[model samples]
Target: MIQLIECPRDAMQGLPEFIDTAIKAAYINQLIEVGFHTIDFGSFVSPKAIPQMRDTAEVLEMLDLHKAKSKLLAIVANVRGAEDALRFEEIDYLGFPLSVSETFQQRNTNASIAQALETVETIQNLCQTKGKEQVVYLSMGFGNPYGDPFSPDLVAEFVQKLDELEVKTISLSDTIGVATPELITEIFQVQITSFPHITFGAHLHSRVEDINEKVLAGLKGGCRRFDGALKGFGGCPMAKDELIGNMATEVMIETFKEEGYSLDLNQMELEEAIKLSNSIFL
Candidate 1:
């Protein structure tokens, strides 16, 4: 079965206005009932960096997790954020973005590539000690517009480094929605074939017109995990001003169903969550 990760935090982070903590928790609580494998629910970053998510801990307090089947994953930019997130025993995974592009690395995390790698090693150690897992996102896993050097070989080398650190899960991110379907296939094929032990995920950003092709390409390249947001709502604010939306979760579900892939989702709950999204995003 494919693992669908609902990313409401990613959907909301770049918004200019702040969402109410109660409302954010209500939406995520409903999503938890939809039975996704995981929910990318919130982050532990600085309020200055992402003021929209300043209430993540407050939101977590409101979630009704006693009956929740889905795991919670929070994004952390550095070891400090990771430490903050670790204090919450309810959080199951910590996500760290490690960009292959030097320019993006600094822009997104305020750290160079070397510094980010060291942070990952430190966070991985914390997770191990705290009994939590880490999910590393290869931001700019596709090409970038900053004139940064990029290639399939470069991505493979990063994978090797992370693998040496015993990082088990990595998501290839199309940070600015610049990935072609061909490139998606080629990159995922290389990483999956080369590192059989690691679980590869696709966190693709795209225009509505290109969503189907990109989703299909990831599947064809042997990726079973994917991250999506309702209605394709958000993108990386640090990447650019004109953000490319996330892969729409509903569109992905449609494509997977048409391809004869079975997903373990609660249709009734999904419909309710979609209704709530209409209210929250506007």
Candidate 2:
């Protein structure tokens, strides 16, 4: 059975317009009914930077988790963002995204790789103190567009830094959709062997054809807890050429279904989710 994670909120990042907060909160309840064990809902960042996520706080307040079978994820770019997220009761998971490529890190978050990890350390400590789960999103874990050479050793070293922070979950992000199946195997081999207890997963940006290859490698590497967006909505605009950022949940379901795996998603419930997503950004 595949434990497919859905990411509706993250999927809308690249959307050009900001939907009404009330409408957003209204749709979130629909997604909660589906069987996705987790949903990366929204991020706490500057409105000017990622306008699509500007309503995060209000959306969290409006979210109805009366049937909270699925965990909630809130992306935080830095210590202050994580600090702001801690003030909310509706959020269940705190995600920290750090790009392995230095140039991309500076472009995306205005922080170098080292500075980002320092922020992660601070955020991780705060999450532990505030009783929140910390997740590391290793952006460009597969490859980067900034001419940085990708390698398993570099990724392993980054994961080692994440381990030191004691984060419970980690995601290898294919930031620019450059990861091939062979590299996926190499990178996964190192991290999974080193951190057996950590719940690691993939946060991909590649097309449908590429997903299976990477997912297969992830499975072979003993990874669990992958993430995907609904209807392929979101991607980081800062990426070169505005690349699509997340793996779509609908596509994810189709792939997992072929293998007879399930995250227990109700087909009718998912259609409702799609409607909710369309109503917001389409």
**Every candidate's lDDT:** 0.96, 0.80
Question: Model 1, 7-35: lDDT tens per residue?
Answer: 99999999999998999999999999999
Summarize candidate 2's per-residue lDDT along 1-282 as a digit string, tens digits: 566777767767777877778877777777888868887888999898989899899888887787678888899888889989999866778988888888888888899998998999898888888888988888888878778766788888888878877887888888777777777777777778889877788887867666666677766766666787776667778888867556767876776777667567788988988887876765
Q: What's the count of clashing pairs in each model shown?
A: 0, 2
TM-score, one value per model: 0.99, 0.94
Among all candidates shown, the one with the greatest lDDT? 1
Clash list (residue pairs), candidate 2 = 11-234, 235-245
lDDT of 2: 0.80
